[model samples]
Target: MTKPLIEITNINKSYQNGDQELRVLKDISLTIDEGEFVAIMGPSGSGKSTLMNIIGLLDKPTSGNYDLEGQEVDSLGDQELAKVRNQQIGFVFQQFFLLAKLNALQNVELPLIYAGVSPSKRRELSKQYLEKVELVERMHHLPSELSGGQKQRVAIARALVNSPAIILADEPTGALDTKTGAQIMDLLTDLNREGKTIIMVTHEPEIAAYATRQIVLRDGVITEDTRKGGEI
Candidate 1:
């Protein structure tokens, strides 16, 4: 049998808060298969962001096991973890974290530059992904020159440029208006249909509805896990 793309078990995260321990995630365990579109939903302080960080390899759990593509990741060193993160996970943020100075194409090309791709190949891949996000025409535009949705599209293109195993989107629609948010969600839905594994963090029910599976977190614990067909 094929292994899951991501398998996490008994994960917990905590932080030190002025001599007190503040738990952010509580004994969470979940598996995500390739091509699944999952939404992690919660109110503020629900540990959804913490969970996303752990899944994206940006933060370590206080304790737990995480296996990406069947390999244990909890044991990797900082450099190893960075390498894995760079190669395996793509990130999209609510802030659309594009560099203000870089044009859309250059921003998308940044990952390949870090990955040490040839300059020509970086340009080729970046343009391809920008086209994929339907922002090729605006490739030379800076973040400030683009609309909110266009900026997010560039962010999406950057996320796709690495061809990572999973796309981790945190409040992707938070920075846009309703109509533009819907358009972004439609793009995400279309990407999922094309076999990308998307894990999105969202507080909005309308946004979560775009995903095939919804996992609700409350007070650092998973309160509900539901699939479109039924509860899972």
Candidate 2:
């Protein structure tokens, strides 16, 4: 059998708030196979964002195990975690987190720089991903010079430039208008069809509809896990 791309088992997370312990996630178990597009949906405080952070290696679970590409990662040190995050995960956020000083191509090349890719190779790969996202013409434009949709496309291109094992998007369309959001979703769907594993967190049902599978959370627990057009 082909190994799953992501395996998360019995995970939990909590934070201390004054004298209280606030649990953000509880006993979560999930598996994502390669080439699958998964969506996570929930209301505010549902722990959806927390789960996304753990899955993206930005945070560690309070308990249990997580494996990425068959390698255990829950116990890695901070530096190692950073390395893995750089090499294995690409992140897309609602806000286009592009550096204002950098142009689109330069933003895309940032990850490659950390990965120690040569200058020529970085430019080549960044340009290819920009082309893939249909942003080749805006390659030299700064974030402020692009439209909202164009900025998001530039962000997506930056995410793809690393060729990471998975793309973790959090509320990727929250900042766009309906039409622009739909265009971004269509772009994501195309990327998933091309075999990139994706896990997106969104509160919008229309946005979630683009995913092959949907997982809904409530009060730090999974309330539903279902495929598109199917019951849990």
Candidate 3:
């Protein structure tokens, strides 16, 4: 049988605050298969962001196991984790994190540059992803010159440029108006239909509705996990 793309088991995360331990996540377990579109939903301080960070490899759990493509990741060193993250996970953020100085194309090329792809190949791949995101015409525009939606599109292009196994989006629509947010959700839905595994963090029910599965976190524990058709 094929393994799940991501398998997280008994995950626990905590932080130290002035000699007190603050638990952010408690004994969470989940599996995400390739091509699944999952939304992690919660109110403020529900540990949803912490869970996203662990899944994205930006943070480790205080305890428990995370396996990406069947390989144990909890024990990986920072460098090794970085390498794995670059190769297997692409990130999109609420702020659209594009460099203000770089044009859309250049921003998309950043990942390939870090991966050490040839310059010509990087340009080629970046343009291809920009086209996929329908932002090729704005390739030369800087973040300042683009609209909020356009900036997010560029961020999406950058996320796709690496061809990572999973795309992790944290509050992707938070920075846009309703219409623009819907457009972005449509784009993301299209990408998911094309077989991309998308894991998104959002507090809005409307935004979370775009995903096939919704996992609700409350007070550091998963309160609900539901698929669109029914519970899973």
Clashing pairs in 2: none
Q: Where in model 2 is the C-alpha error above 4 Å?
A: none
Taking every candidate in turn, the Cα RMSD to the unseen true structure, in Å, is 1.0, 1.1, 1.0
User: Which digits, one per residue and each the tens of the lDDT, describe model 1 over residues 95-199?
Assistant: 999999999999999889889999999999999999998999999999999999999999999988889999999999999999999999999999999999999
Query: Could you tell me how far off, in angstroms, the CA of residue 98 lies in candidate 3 after the best superposition?
Result: 0.7
Q: In candidate 2, where is summed lDDT lowest over 10 consecutive residues? A: 69-78
| Tens-digit lDDT track of model 2 for 1-232 | 6569999999999899999999999999999899889999999999999999999887888898999888899668888889988888999999989999999999999999999999999999999999999999999999999999999999998888888889999999999999999999999999998889999999999999999999999999999999977965
Give the count of colliding residue pairs in each prediction.
0, 0, 0
Question: What are the TM-scores, per candidate, against the unseen true structure?
Answer: 0.98, 0.97, 0.98
lDDT of 2 at 208: 94
Residue 45 lDDT, candidate 1, scale 0-100: 98
Better of 1 and 2 by TM-score: 1
lDDT of 3 by residue, 68-136 (tens): 998999768888898888878999999999999999999999989889999999999999999998999
Candidate 3 CA-lDDT value: 0.94
